[model samples]
Target: MSASLSVGARDLPRTAARRVADGLALAAAPTFALMAILVGAGGSDVGQMLCAGEQGLQIGGMTVMYMLMSVFHLTPWLRLIQSGKREAA
Candidate 1:
């Protein structure tokens, strides 16, 4: 039982890391597409403003989402560490 539990625990972090990486890739795709379009459109002032605003929002939103997801992914580890410290105390 302890061995199985240890194996499960080891798998958990790797699975969570894969999920976070997948999520980052998913989040980045649209941002990259938008950037490509913006670049191809030739930075006329109007085009620049429009694309800049749109890309800014998209990238910023993705950045925030990534940060939140990262925090969420770390939460379990953090809790485990804190609990360990408490137990040690």
Candidate 2:
């Protein structure tokens, strides 16, 4: 029907937006985790090498920032897991 088609057309953008948001939610955790791992492992030496001429730059800052980002991004994953548990129960 024309009315159904119109409704579906209106929902198309909303559905696309939801999918995009879900994709970002799924992507954020692993992206931040990888960043944190890389920064925590050998970031100090890499930072020193990169900023050889800079003064008083703390390499730990980047590691901490990435760690915080990873922590913050875990919320989406936690919510996802909670939803899964709810469905199972």
State each model's CA lDDT, in order.
0.61, 0.80
RMSD of model 1 against the true structure: 9.9
Give the per-residue lDDT digits (tens) of candidate 1, residues 1-89: 99999999999999999989766655554555555445434434566667667433333444455545555455455655798999999
How far residue 56's Cα lies from its native spot in candidate 2, in Å, is 21
The best candidate by lDDT is 2
Worst 10 residues of 1 by lDDT: 54-63
**Deviation of model 1 at 10, angstroms:** 0.4
